[model samples]
Target: MSADSMRVRRSFSRVWPVALLAGPGLAWAQVSPPAGEAAAPAAESSASAGSADEPVASSPSAPYLRTQIGMVLETRPTYLGSPNRETKLRPVLGLQYGRFRLSSSRASLVESSGGGGQLSGASVDLSPRGPWSLNAALRIDHGRGAGDDPLLAGLPEVRQTVRGRVSARYAITPSWSAGASLSTDLLGRKGGTLGALDVGWSTMLTPAWRWTLGGGLGLADATYMRSYHGISPEVAAATSRTAYVPGAGMHGVGVSTGLTWNVSPAWRLGATGAFGRLTGPAVDSPLTQARNNWSVSVGAVWVKDWRD
Candidate 1:
């Protein structure tokens, strides 16, 4: 063969291998597998990608298990009318687990005329499902000086009071709710039992602010006339002969209003005022009529949320 012919044969041989090598990729680009087979790998890849994103969904569950704790301080310079005047400093602590919350408050009141001391209480609030919620609390209040009567002399005293309240609220609008509460108080010597029924309207004025107004009527029956002014032995002796006095059974109406502002995600401030008037056989008595009173208080509250 001539040299040119030999070179042409070598070039042809090189071109044939290159063509063979490119055939598979070109065919792959132009042709597709059967619909079922082709779709499967794509579906699998998509699923694997989705699985990688699955962990992001678990983020929401973190709030449920997270614990929220807070401390609060409150001061009430004077409540009602007591000669000594009053100041109360209360420290509050709370823990929330899911929809259940457990809390306690310790109150110390100082009276210039009479020495001041402490009162403490614990409460549990639970909301299992829906808009319904329940709350129960037990409180013990201890202080010396005048009891409930402004006219009476101070008495050395120890008293235990337990209170339970249950309420049902239904949302009337995005910003308003209507609710009612049944509350009972059991007082232990110088002790009495009081039952109250209250209906209220609550409104959310802003995202972090709310207001409530409520009114109720209640009955209080006492075993003895426990006066803030200690009953002199003479007065007790005079009343002792009478087994039960019709004047001791009293019924009254009460009204309350409160405002709460959420200062931040975890801090809140609230002010509340309440007034009551007695209207019954007991009200005619000088002592009972004088005891009709009103009280005002301002407090700071803190709340935290936990979810699971």
Candidate 2:
């Protein structure tokens, strides 16, 4: 086998395990598809497997370290579905090598990666070039605690739980795509199953500027609903709130939009915002302070990379 053939084979070998953990691929998890969408991995794998004996050679592009450093300012609700909001200032830093990228969902090196309900955390893209993108991520779900709010004083103190997620996104077009992702409580603090369905569009305003808009539908099973939105009988009695139990259904809908400017090869700037509204049983719960939530983010990015 030639060097080029060997490289593809090696890539396939590394990617299959991720595919298994994720049940194959293709589905929108949250985030932007890297500027240069990966080459079609399935097609390349198939073509290469059939011609393993063919002699071929092509110089590999010199590897380069791509890094982004900056700061992001974000504003959103104090809690999910909260009527009040707060603003946060966070540092932005990210790096990518070959097919693997390490970055926050907002420390974008490509373009905007927000949907209606994006969570901030660390994530790694474990996908090859193509229509499919997959990510393994970890985040903190700061569950509500007693006294955290006057209304939640008597309710159980939901200890913060670390969480993990596996998601996939498929690009249906250069400007359209759809995806689904599943998240689970890694520490098992009763943060039941949560999911999101993503669909979005992007277009260039100029050679160096782009616009993106995307929608995400949120879903939660009984456990997640009960923990985050429900008022149990015992808790309701103590707190004098109405007792309610919720089942699985479409819990919310959200829309996110962004304006990104590629000021130069090493400098980028962007602004993004999202609006979300709770639906289904979650909307009917008495504990719900409000059915609507929103957030906005702005950032400046400086990148260190060498290549076209």
Candidate 3:
């Protein structure tokens, strides 16, 4: 390996833990109020442009643009260890321009919503069909510091990373979709690569209420597995933990369900719950204490539509 590769590996072993966006487990729905009617925007409502599950609505004379702002609350593992839990309040922002979209928050690709990940940085989308979309994104993966937990005090600090991802989504019907994604280390921060496949279904229960369901499979490469789960002998001796190496393969499976209510044309309310389990090396790693991962999020969004 090159010197840079060695350095990256060392840094990988020393890095700390951070949060990931709970993708594949959430869904979204968009509904426009009856024609010739308008609704007041609520400060805490959820309304945004159409996602993958629906076609992008448009006007004959103007490009469609919408902006969404909101906040989400969730509890997730502090690191990969699962022994520590962190509850965080994450701000949400999403924008749409014609066939282009941008957002910091994530939704499953199957729902044509930007699938889950961290709630920072930005992602861009391109759709060539009413039912298919492609996306590229840059995001921050917060690193972990050994000192944050006694069990990791002597380990190296994992620094924050800026990584990139490319993904594609397809809407099979107005209420169902499927997609895939690939993410890789862009900043060379020892961040590894990840791949995933997802499917989702959404429907309207009433004129104002909608619900969605989704599931996914996750895969990791050897580099990602070793960087995040591998243990070195020297360090194992120091920490008195067995040195182990993990191989790359299928690593996780997840499911998500969500509900949304349109209070008005401009305001919306939504909530989601997701459950996931680690498999293969991720669960077998010495650093891991549990195999189950779960989260819940609730938020409201207010949308502003612009004509150009």
lDDT of 3 by residue, 84-159 (tens): 6666666556654433444543331112233222212344455553667666655555545676556565666655
lDDT of each: 0.34, 0.54, 0.52
Ranking by lDDT: 2, 3, 1
Off by over 4 Å in 1: 1-87, 104-120, 125-132, 141-150, 154-158, 161-190, 224-235, 238-250, 285-292, 302-308
Q: lDDT score, residue 58, model 1?
A: 11
Tens-digit lDDT string for candidate 2 (1-308): 56655665566557644543342111211211111111001100111111110101111234434556777777665555556655667666554444333444443333212211122244555555577766666655555676555666678876666667676666677667666667777788887777766666767789888776666666777887888778899988888888998898776766666676889977888776666677777788776787776666788888766333
Quote the lDDT for 286 in model 2.
76
The residue-level lDDT of candidate 3 at 178 comes to 75
Off by over 4 Å in 2: 1-63, 105-122, 306-308
For every model shown, what is its TM-score relative to the native structure?
A: 0.52, 0.72, 0.72
Compute the lDDT of residue 193 as modeled in candidate 1. 40
* Clashes within 3 Å, all models in order: 7, 9, 14
Residue-by-residue lDDT tens digits, candidate 1, 108-217: 11100111110113333333445443444344323223343343333334243344444344444433344333333345435344344344455668887766555555
At residue 308, give the lDDT of candidate 2: 34
